[model samples]
Target: MGKEFSSVPMYTESAEVTKSFDDDGRIKRTGTLLTASSHIITAVIGSGVLSLAWAIAQLGWVVGPAVLMAFSFITYYTSTLLADSYRCPGPVQGTRNYTYMDVVRSHLGGVKVQLCRLAQYGNLVGVTIGYTITASISMEAIKKSNCYHKHGHDAHCSEPAYPFMIIFAAIQIVLCQIPNFHELSWLSIVAAIMSFAYSSIGFGLSVAKVAGGGNNVRTTLTGTTVGVDLSGSDKVWRTFQAIGNIAFAYAYSTVLIEIQDTLKSKPSENKVMKKASFIGVTTTTIFYMLCGCVGYAAFGNDAPGNFLTGFGFYEPFWLIDFANIGIAVHLIGAYQVFAQPIFAFVEKSCQKRWPESKFINAEYMPFMGSHGFNMFRLVWRTIYVVVTAVLAMIFPFFNDILGLIGAASFYPLTVYFPIEMHIAQQKIPKYSFNWMWLKILSWSCLVVSLVAAAGSIQGLAVDVKTYKPFK
Candidate 1:
């Protein structure tokens, strides 16, 4: 990765410098509705969606699809509220808040900003860890799938996720060099396509199985029947855990304002972002409905965590392997999508705190284009990736981890912050209908998040007792 660049050059402004900047005096944000939607899709439809079948299986026919729709609606509505917060005081004329933290600090200044920062970044870190585990499992699935194709379906072909986790981390370390969310358009597009590819493949395979009529399809109205499937308490925990999984699938608001900051102020950033959210959430919901509903139909209560990678479809192993490949490739981009904000935060903070530090401020630019190479970014980002990969290896339980992350972050980042910001920004009356309903909604989500978190913790405890680390 060494570049033959000379010493750091002196800074000078030129006519050809394209010195245009956004209202915030940063680099011009050229992101369009399409690109914003692309970023949203990449963030929204990820390893989280791959587990929806299992979530649906837990919730069953009516509740499963209904929950998916409910989340889609909630996500879109809150996303619009978040969009307006991208600019304070006014939707278009107000000053821009660069990241989610900036939006919180602008509207709900105080410890609330720190709380938002913690939940936002903490959730981002947890998501990166979840992605590492999911991507490694996808990589391992390719190997196991090919083995099943060559040998018998019942053949022993399992492999440890450690090697694949390392591989995923290495790739993310390289991508972390992309610098910021504004520079990730191409990656977001590629990752969005990959998400759609794998989701479609999973949906198609499930539909095919249902049409085949060979496999026994078991189902229920309210989901896993009590006493028949498990004890009453187990059902309660799993049901709540499943809700967390669905919540995770709808999670993208942690970066919503960040993504909004990338838009050009024409028809207004808030307007564009709202449209993008509608498009993104609507498209994501369609995919979720198709994949989760049909996968549940195909396997009923026995639907695996991942229909493709969970050995639900052994025949036509090539397609399964391809879907798994899609998952890994998509996660390669999604990880960067989530990780870039953290990278930017830490780097910006260090530079702000130590403006005179050469290691933090100076950027070595190679002869090719305007890209700058900073030692701090390189080393720190690599360390971040490595730590997440290590954590993923230490705890590879996918569903439980996803549920935990989703439950931990869903309310504060997605629901509570946006509602509070909106109520403050719009100056909704204290005892007015809007304020009352908004408070009710936020409280309801908080309850759901807490219950789901408890369920995930219980599930993780159970898994930890039985599973050995690094296996």
Candidate 2:
């Protein structure tokens, strides 16, 4: 299992020599390990963490953390493979791949590159929708909690998720205007802090509840214990859903190369990325463990998909408001971080397709420099954000959207492609134990991802029929 790590070189000399310059002839790359790790953490720890209790309900206490840790390790390993895969043979020396699609184009050719783009775009868009849903739900929770505190049992909070979804979309529209990936580092830092803050609050609240007596728990249990004894096909499907949740929570590999491309030292960017990924994943995993375990213990089998909303009229209403605010803030940053690559791809694609278009050059516009807003940025991004917001308003099932994205995209992006690219880059023989094992791992991951995707799609279909748009 660890053989893959030893197979790929830490850094290629060609990557160190490659240089990218802006029109002004200044150094365009900028990132330290801390900023890089912050972005990775922001990308990895989004609204997905709020659903860890639902995943725990599927897998139980004994198996939940173990599976979560395993997925974390797998994601880290694949991310490193992806980081190393950026080095390819240039016309003179070797070229460094900057984007996810670039790596596929370099290794698998143009056909696979399109497929990779589809998956990458779909995953990012899915994540954006999930963020909107989560943010809207968080705002709704705060409103409900406040109303309950004021009016006791008769309080009724009538505000729906639709308006909040629109508000979240509007916030993202502004944040997404930040042009450079490296420039968003400060925003990522703030998002990371918010993630830690809310996670800590949830963990502390769950622990305090479990310590007091567990009488407020709403679910019937085997004896008052936390774990559920899952059996039959229901268990099977929930286990698959749990895998998707864990995978989605850790699925930040698509942007690894793009993030690495921002590092000042190209030669050591691979090592820097590996270090950042480890730190980010480890930190998120600890938070996940604390939140998931205590949340399940506090709620039992009846835990809601979104844990923050599941709290429902609890004491210390101010803390709930604070945590929900953190979630809303964090998602605003997370949306921009994930959506930047998609925006860049679209802009580049449009320029390529229409070379004579006035939007190609940022030279004439008043507020536009080389990295400033262009016509596509004003038109396409606005449309993209609005469309995504409408999707969120229509289908507001947070966990199901996550599961669908993870099942559809994670295996290919996180597991299969990285492993395949590693074997291809290293030219490892098919008969070799390392290659064989990686193939088996990739296939197993693919089968599981497919099952999770199927379950998510089925669940989503049912939700479509039963759930109202603005309710």
Q: Which candidate is the best by lDDT?
A: 1
What TM-score does candidate 2 get on C-alpha atoms?
Answer: 0.89
* CA displacement after TM-score superposition, residue 56 of candidate 1 (Å): 1.0
Error of 1 at 160 (Å): 0.4
Task: Give RMSD (Å) of candidate 1 vs. truth.
Answer: 2.5
TM-score for each of the candidates: 0.96, 0.89
Q: How would you encode candidate 2's per-residue C-alpha lDDT over 1-471 as one tens digit per residue?
A: 111111122245344423554222335567889888999999988887998988887777667878788888888888888878876642113466769888888877857777888889888888888888888999888888888888884656666888888888887777776665767888999999999999888888888878889455644322123344444655666677777887788878878888887775644677888899999999999899888878888877767788887753277999989999999999888888888899888877776787667655342323433344455577778889999999888888887788888888888899877887888788889879999889888988888798888777776876788787765
| Candidate 2, residue 393: how far the Cα is off, in Å | 0.9
Candidate 1, residues 14-100, lDDT tens digits: the string is 323344655555556688999999999999999888889899988888888998898888889999999999888887899888899
Give the C-alpha miss distance for residue 99 in model 1, angstroms. Answer: 0.5
The window of 10 residues in a row where model 1 has the poorest summed lDDT is: 6-15
Q: Which ten residues in a row have the lowest lDDT in candidate 2?
A: 1-10
